[model samples]
Target: MPRKLLILIADGMGDYPAQELDGRTPLQAARTPNMDAAAAQGTVGTCRTIPSGMPAGSDIANMAIMGYAPKRYHTGRGPIEAAAQGLDCAPSDLIYRLNLCTVSELSPSGLMLDHSGGHIQNEEALNLLQVLRTELDTDQVQIIPGFQYRHLLKHTDGVGTLEAGLDLVPPHDILNTPLAPALEVYARSPLLDSMIHRAHSILTSAWNQTQANAIWPWGQGPPLALPSFAHTFGLRGAVISAVDLIKGLGRAAGMDVLDVPGATGLVDTNYQGKVQAALNFLEHGDFVFVHLEGPDECGHAGDLDCKIQAIERFDEHIVGPVMLDLARMEGAVCMACDHLTPVGVRTHTTEPVPFCFLDSRQIQSGAHEGFSEAAAAAGDVHLEAGHLLLPYLLDRMQEADG
Candidate 1:
C-alpha cells in the first residue's frame, strides 16, 4: 500500500487563543494525547501559505499548501469552490464565491456596521440565491446557491478565465488582505452595476423584507485551475472546509470534500464525525484534508473563550486522533493554519503562522508540547506565510518516496 498523508487544516488555528488560558492555546491546552504522541514521532516545523510581500486569500493560501505557486498556477474562484462542493468545472464556465451581505446605505460607512447581514444561515442564503437566479433575465450568466455565505454565478462563455480580481475592501480588507481599490473601479463600470442590480432586484422581491433581504454579492470572478496537494505530493487528496474559498481551492485543484453534518461554521462545531471521517478516508486514500472553520469563526466573532475551545477541539479531537491513526497506518500527518485570525482584530492577520508535523518513522517519540504558535515562540521553528509549508510538505513526501 502507498504511504498515506493526513493534512489537518484548522481554519484560523494559531497560537494566540492559548494566551487566555495560562499561555496554552487550544492546541496546547487541550488533551491531545494522540496528536502530542504523533508530534513526538515526527518532525514538527512551520511553513508559509502566504509568502512575504504578497497579498493572500484562503484560496491562494491553500493552493500554496498543496504546492502550487500562485503566479504560475492561478485560476478563478468558481472552479476552486465547485471542487469542494463536489461540482467539477468543465473548464469553460467561470466560478465565483458569493456573499449574502446586506446592501445597506453607504451612509454610515463605518466598518463595524457595514457588514450588517453577518453569516446568514444556509436556508436563507439559498432562498435569496434562488430568487436572484430566476430574476436576472438579461445576462447570459446563471446564478446558483452554495453555502451560507457562498453561491455560484456561472457565465456560459467557455473558459473565460476570469481573474479572482477581488479588490482590497470589506471581506478582503475588512476581514483580511486589504491592498487594492478594485471595487471602486469595478463599481463605476456598468458591468458592476448590472451585477449588483440583478441581486438587488431579487432581494427587494415580494418575499424579502428590504432591510435585511437586500443581499449584496461580491468577489466576482471565474473558476480557477491551479495545481493541488495531490498533484504536488502524489497523494490522493480531499479538503474539508466551511470557507467556500478553501473548498473552492480544493475544487480547482481536483480534490473532493468530506461531508460533515451540523457544521454550523460557529464556535460550536461538529467534531466527532470530522475526526472519524478523516481516519476512515486515510485508511483508504493517501491524503485527507480536514478544514475546521470554527476557530476562524470564533476569531471573527471575537469570542476568546469560544476561540480557545475551537482550537481545543482540534488538539483534543481532530489532530490528536489523526496522529494516532497515522501511527497505526505508518503514515505522516501535518497541522497548520492558513492565516492568523487574531481575536484582537477579529480579522485575518498578515503575521506568519507556525506548522507542526508528525510521523512515526521520522521521530520515534510521536508527540511534543511546543510545536504550534502558542509554544512555537518557545519551540525551535518559526515559519512565515502559509505557502512555505508546501515546499517542506513536498520535501517530506519525496523523502518517503525515497
Candidate 2:
C-alpha cells in the first residue's frame, strides 16, 4: 500500500497582520501550538496564497495549491461546484456556482453578501433554493443543492451567448472597487435579474412561512471553471469545505464532497470532523483536502480578536489532531493555504503565506521562525507556494517508494 499522505489547508490563512490594531499580528496572537510544533519538527517555507500575478479566489488559488496550473486546469466555476453537490458535468457545459446571498439595496454596495448567503443556515438556504427551483421554469435552468450558504444552477441548453458570469459585483462595500464597476454593467442582464427575482420571491415566501426575517439572495449567474488538483497530480483527491465555492472548486476538479454537519462557513467550524474525514481516505492512495474558512472570515470582518480565537481553536482542535493522525500514517504531510486574508483587511493580499511540512523524515529548516509571518520570513524556505510544494511532494513520494 502507498503511504497515507495527509494535507491540511487553511483557506485564506497567510495574512498575519503586523501591528494593525492590537499590536500583535493575528498569527502571533493565535494559539497554534500544533502548527507551531509541526514547524519545529519539520520544514518551514514562505509561500504565496497563489502564484504571483493572478487574481486570488478559491477558484484559481485552490487549483494552484492542489498542483494544477490555473491557466490549464480551470474548467469554469459551475462544473466545479456541481461536483461537490454530487452532480456531474461535461467539458462543454458552462457551469457556475451560485451564492444565494443577501445584498443591501443601499448606498455603494457591490451586490455581494457578507456570508456566502448572509450566513443562512442550510434548512433556510435549502428551503429558499427549493422555492427558486420551482419558480425557474426555463428548459435549460437547473438548480442543485450546495451544503450551506450556497447553491448550484446551470443553463443546460448552452446559453453561452447570454450567460451572465458569477464574477458579478459583490454586495460588500469593502470589496467595492472591483465588483461594483463590473456588477453595474452586468446586473442589466434580464436572465440574471429573473433568477434574482425568483430567488427574492422564494426568500419572501420563506420569510412568510418561517416568520423569520433574513437577507435575501443577491448574487446570481454562473462562473467559468479553473483547473483542479485531480487533473494535475494524476491522483484522485477529495476537498471538504464549508464554503460552497470551495466545494464547487472540488467539483470542478472532478472530486467528491464529504458530507459534514454544522459546516457553517465560519471560524467556529468542525475542524476535528474534517481531520477524521481526510484520514479516512487513507485506504486509497489519494489526497484529502480540508479547508477552514474562519480566520479569513474574521479577517474580512475586521474582528482580530475573533480571528485569534479561531486560529487557536484550529491549533487545539484541528491541526494538532491532523498532525497526530499523519504521524501514524506512512506518507509525508503537506500544509498550506489558498491566500493571505489579513485581519481588518479581509481581502486577499499578495504577501507571502507560510507553509510547513511534517513527516518522519528529516526536513531542511533554513532559519525561518516556527510560527507567524515575521517568523516565517526569517526562515530559508521563501519562494512561490504552488511551484514548490506539489512537485516536492511528488518527488518525496517517489523517493520513498524508490
Q: How far is candidate 1 from the true structure (C-alpha RMSD, Å)?
A: 4.2
In candidate 1, what are the lDDT values of residues 122-153, reduced to their tens digit?
77766666667776734556666777766666
Model 1 TM-score relative to the real fold: 0.80
Q: What TM-score does candidate 2 reach?
A: 0.81
Worst 10 residues of 1 by lDDT: 105-114
Residue-by-residue lDDT tens digits, candidate 2, 1-402: 244566677766666556754566777767787788777777777766465665666666776666667666555545556655656654444555566555443223533336455466778767766666777746766777666655666666443545534344333323423235544444666665566655555565525454222222233333445455566666777878787667766666667667677666688777777777777876674777778877777766667778778778767877777777664666577666667777655677766677777765544453344577666677667767665567776676676565
Each candidate's TM vs. the true structure? 0.80, 0.81
The per-candidate count of clashes, in order, stands at 34, 27
